[model samples]
Target chain A: MGWFRKKEKPQEVVTEKKDLWTICPSCKAHVYKDEWDKNFSVCPQCNFHDKINWKERMDILLDPGTFREINDNVSTADPLEFKDSKGSYAEKAEATKVKTGMKEAVITGRGKIHGIRVVMAVMDFRFLGGSLASGTGEKILLASEYALRHKYPYIVVSASGGARMHEGIISLMQMAKTCAGVARLKKMGIPYISILTDPTTGGVSASFATMGDINIAEPKALIGFAGRRVIEETIKQKLPDDFQTAEYVLDHGFIDQIVNRKEMKNFLYKVLRYWKAK
Target chain B: MNLDFEKNAPEIEEKIAELTKQKATDPNAKVDDQIVGLKKELDKVLKEAYAHLTPWQTVQVARHPNRPLLRDYIAGMCGEFIELHGDRCFGDDKGIIGGFATIADSHVMIIGHQKGKNLEDNVKSNFGMATPEGYRKALRLMKLAEKFKIPIITFIDTPGAYPGADAEARGQAEAIARNLTEMSQLEVPVIVVVTGEGGSGGALGIGVGDVILMLSNSVYSVISPEGCASILWRDGSKAPEAAEALKITANSLFKLGIVDEIIPEPIGGAHRDYDGTLQAVKQALLKHLNILRRVSERKLVDRRFEKYCRIGRFKHR
Candidate 1:
């Protein structure tokens, strides 16, 4: 008798209008998340550059599904057993691992950029502020070694605060370790292009991040040897508004060129093509 | 003028000065016995204090105003020294001094972080902090040394590279990176000594070497304990605790396998006995150089690269 006279129609799918937006660091404009992601996290109105996570960074730089990560098993040793008022260094790293879903600050892999095979290491600023630790250094060195053996172009995109202080001297030595790794490629005349993003300072800035055959950076990226506040304190003078910007260093002859995020992949492809012999 | 751990040092020094002044005024002043006794007591005090120096105290000793510097070492060991200056791209950086010199009859390129002995000198050298040009000059000299088939010896004593606007504008990072990359394949034996404050990347700019030596009371840290405390604890007063945790002392660094050998200092520290410290450093240099001289140039470069390559303590799973 209750022959379903009227099955309730499926609820009409409501278009999600939830406010997901990115606040541009420079212009403070709220860009819709989808639009921002589509633009590689760049602001549409002000055209300000925003940092992307490692996954986004990889996807933006590499061919679809072509990345095979190398040295993925490397992890920190907590060499110092460092503990601070915040927490233990080992525990902090573990938490960062869970949060960032990354083993170390840097992720090294082999991938194709515009169908050109290359080995690359890209730093994730989300992971412990992209501080270089033993694991980061090891992964970079191993990747560089792989590139050297294969005679492939090596590229490193650096976005870091500096050395991870928890590892102490080991953290500082990562500079030397990574530089030696890069030097190997340099000695063999391999193309090493260093793409510096915003806020590349301190130990990383003073290491392989700067030692590139072609050093290019993003527009308005803060690239310098020391922190701006540190420089302000030491010099007892206020820095200009554009201090440490990529354009500023370019004017000073520290960097080669500034490439926009959208054009980065194409620019790298061109460089690889230039070095490649058909 | 501030002593971190040696208690009564300033007062004892003042008393010694007073007695010496009195003796000078009155040629027959009977203060010789007192002065000698006080000096003996002072030595005892220094020995006892230095024997138990915490890592923070060692840091202070490393940066002590009167600590013997590269100039003193040059006078003691580098015979027939001629300083080479200028990066040729910019003005000569006074923060680091490099030269061609004979060390025990071997012509080596001697480079070191130079601190001023006086106020004017400090101003000129920027308190031992280097500009980008300083590192560039060092690289220039190391290349020169390689061309001459000579070994390279560098002394690390800076608090750090200058964290200033001009330094950044001038490419401090690139300058240091050049040294790190070029030095690894320079085809010359490189010997490095941490004579004092081994400040972060600044010290490591010229720090790559076949053998790394550190003085007993010297410190090599990624950052000053004060800076660490401020960053981690939001309190600069916790510097002592930070120093302890950082393990910046030579013995600690040696235990961590970062420092190859620790050269012995005097009973107190390097500042207390400059000549003794310099002699010990000279002996260590000669000893290591003799060993390095026997190794082939290719082996030296490869070993140097491998030495730094295997430095980090980490795990791979």
Candidate 2:
């Protein structure tokens, strides 16, 4: 070790080049922060659509001056008191508000779409890890009950990552809860429609999303019960190009149609009229 | 090598392999004719074998990749679809899919499980395993249907609820139990179609209905053959034999009075002729819905409850 010791000569160091971030054409890169507000937080560059909260979606989808949200006071409790790296349910809920600006994962209420009375339940991915925990399950159950009582068509806009991690098994129970509620509605013989937006994955896909009397998907929506990566690992094979996309699902006969956002309301109007006639 | 005798064994396999290869190379290859011929041969063997399928074969058919899933039925049968999200509690589950749509002139609520066609989709949908939230979402949609006075339809195709650590932590068993209790008294005319594998509690989570219809090749069982084997023999390999004991095939279940009716599949299977399978499903659903329309709410609920209770009550004497 002593023999290998050598004197070092001083040398000039070169400065490392910084990465040049380009604005994505679809999702506008760094621009004036205020500019995003005008665009509804959608990327100004490439028109990449950012996830919107349930409230914003309601404002956009429902008829003006016809929305009346229900069960806003309901919240979750630490029944199991699950904890993880994300922190406890209490901490997560507070942080979620700061991050996603929502109180819960879903908002259920009565609303009118083109003057057709409907019960609406929209899930917001921003709150509580976008997971379906007991609170979300209960709210949906309540919404279904409301719809059944009022004889209104039920409409739900879905966007979720899966069951909530904090609530543990209670989150998983919602599958049965929601299914039972839907079963009750089925006995009542009312119309129910599910609009599958982007990234409708996990348990949500397994239960009501696939259960709709009419199942519609947004263009390019990623819809499946399991994630693509998980399936790949299980099957030990590469997936097809389209895989869970709306177009691919349509071709495979999973989705009835893939409608654009602009056409969704009109299409729904027609469906509602048909069902109402009968 | 006796070529003549050897030919029969490999013929179907060879044809399928050839067509698969051609399909890989040529996206537009019209192998439909070849596939049709092979399917006919396969169907003859299947009808002969399936008519006498052990519990395990039924399980395999129920889990077949080519089998028509709930999504497939909805796409083929309904005109428009609008998906609903979230259980309105903690989060939204992907295991269950529900919303509103139209069947001919009638507006209806539709719900079902969506198993993925490939790996990614399967994981996304949790292999069609419902969580508590999924059930809750179904509950939400059901209430909505009741409010609107629209009919409700459910297409069940799940192996079971997720048995993973996370799912158990989230209350899987209790949720399924609740569904069993609550669905019995729902006021709507609930129609359930077991389009594919209906495994245990997961299927039961959404299984209650005034009219329960099962596809020709579909199977509904308390537990999957592998699960049964694991419990009974402590070996997964014994699933074939265990399947024989389960008597889970649609025909067997129909005979046992577990299932209300068995909807016929196209010759061979649903995968061979998706359109034809859709037609059959549509006709069956319409027929059932028509009959259900005349039933009073109280009668429907009572009948549905009684139907499930009547299972496995045969005299032992």
Candidate 3:
């Protein structure tokens, strides 16, 4: 008799009592666990985007079983030992790992995209505010040197908020250091491709994002040096529609091309092939 | 809401309408000829008024909302531009836009300050104020140009590098200094053109060139007039007077031997005649490129260094 009663009340009816649904921060729509997972953490109803962690991005980007990260053991030091609302530099580093599951903001290594040899550097927005600190800058410089030494085409998948605020002046020096390295690579006649992902803003946009041999952006990515709101406030004026979108940038002649996620690997491979032929 | 023009336009229109009605009533009236003569006199007065413009007025012209920008020049002068981003170590800056484009059938690296056309674009470009990363990106692109043996052309138009807490934290001053040093030694012909306002270290960071050109109406100065006024006189209002004293106008700079040539603009201004301004720039670019092509890489670099080093010296009697 009890079994028959349980069968009469379905699992959906049982779950209805539990309220197992969460509203998405971006889209303001209710999302179930299965729906969120299936959509790759993207909102299914409105396509509201979220920042994906480094490891997940690597899995999506690199060839299967081909990502061998270099310099994972290296961590940031408090050369100045600065303090803030969160904690000291060292404490923040530890907290970043627990929160984002990545050791640093940038991960660098040699990887294959459709059997084309390339040195890759990716900025993880999850770790330490996705800012360019001394460690992050060092990682980029090291990656550039690696690409030049190995004679591999350099591909940087950037998604940083801006220059790292905590590391101060040292972080800023990284721009010059990394630029010098890139300069060397150019001297060697190696191709450097920069891929602008979602929310590639601030100091990062001003620098490496604008220095690529071929600059490519993701669809609907926000790419600019300063935030739109900041500029509006400063100028005390209204802005035009479609300002700083990948499409708008393409129209304004700021970016080379806007590529979609699914077709990125093939596009990169084609470019690499052409470069090698040249 | 009553617009500002509503207060003045109606009176002028009423007077004109009244005069026209009177002329229509008499076929042999001389009123029409008299009106035409008065209009000509007004036009002459307007020209006379503009002829003796103050330095502050020139500054206003430099910052004109409709003035030509880097995007405008690139579109008018080059073919198939390719933009590069980021300094790789930090982030990409919207202020200093640098990349590759083909000008006159030769591939060249082009760098310039991009002030957004509107509010949102300005913010996106930090109102054309570059950070350490922006200068670094320029350094990177300049090196790339050197490597490729392609000439580097810089269009300087910036108020200055960002003077914010974040910029300082990012070593804005140091990055600019490094660029100043590195660009001087770059083994390629670097041409700098002042299309608009060329302000201070931000302009100088990417401004080392074998031949520096200025637009007829553009202005280049060590410090902005307002800034200079604020520092020297403790008042921003004195900027116009300071502008004249500083000799920042293209004509002044050319007279001082600070710039090589002044590319003429269309009558009224570059804004009024965009195509004509572009043609002037195109011809000037070709002429300079031709001159630079004859010189060896070693000579180009040496001359660029010498040219910059010789700026701002006073002769002792």
Give the Å error, residue B90, model 3.
27
lDDT of 2 by residue, B1-317 (tens): 11121225346767888898999899899997888888678667645654554555556656778777767777888899888889887788887998998887778899888899888988889889888788878878887887887788988899887655334334454455446556767778888888888866688778777777888778776556675566445787877755655556777667755568898876556766789999988888788878888988778766765554343222211
lDDT values for all models: 0.89, 0.71, 0.72
- Per-residue lDDT, model 2, residue B123, is 83
User: Which digits, one per residue and each the tens of the lDDT, describe model 3 over residues B113-223?
Assistant: 999889999989988888888998999999999898888999988886775545644556447745754775688888899888877656766876788899877887656
State the weakest 10-residue window (summed lDDT) of model 3 chain A.
A168-177
- Candidate 2: segments with Cα more than 4 A from true spot: A1-278, B1-51, B314-317
Q: Which stretches of candidate 1 lie above 4 Å from their native place? A: A1-16, A276-278, B2-4, B9-40
lDDT of 1 by residue, A1-278 (tens): 35573343223222233346667787988788889889998888877788888788889999999999998889877888999998899899999899988989999999999899899999999988899989989888999999999998998999999998899999999999999988899889889999999879889999999888899898888888888778888878888989888989899997888999999999999878888567
Winner of 1 and 3 under DockQ: 1
Output the better candidate (1/2) by TM-score.
Answer: 1
Off-target runs (Cα >4 Å) in candidate 3 are: A1-26, A29-39, A43-47, A85-87, B1-185, B188-317
Query: What is candidate 2's CAPRI-style docking category based on DockQ?
Result: incorrect
Question: Measured against the native two-chain assembly using Cα atoms, what DockQ does each of the candidate structures obtain, in the order listed?
Answer: 0.71, 0.01, 0.01
Error of 2 at A205 (Å): 24
Q: What's the best-to-worst order under lDDT?
A: 1, 3, 2
The model with the greatest TM-score is 1
**Candidate 2, after superposition: displacement of residue B235 in Å?**
2.2
Chain A alone, TM-score per model: 0.92, 0.82, 0.84
**Residue A53 deviation, candidate 1, in Å?**
1.2
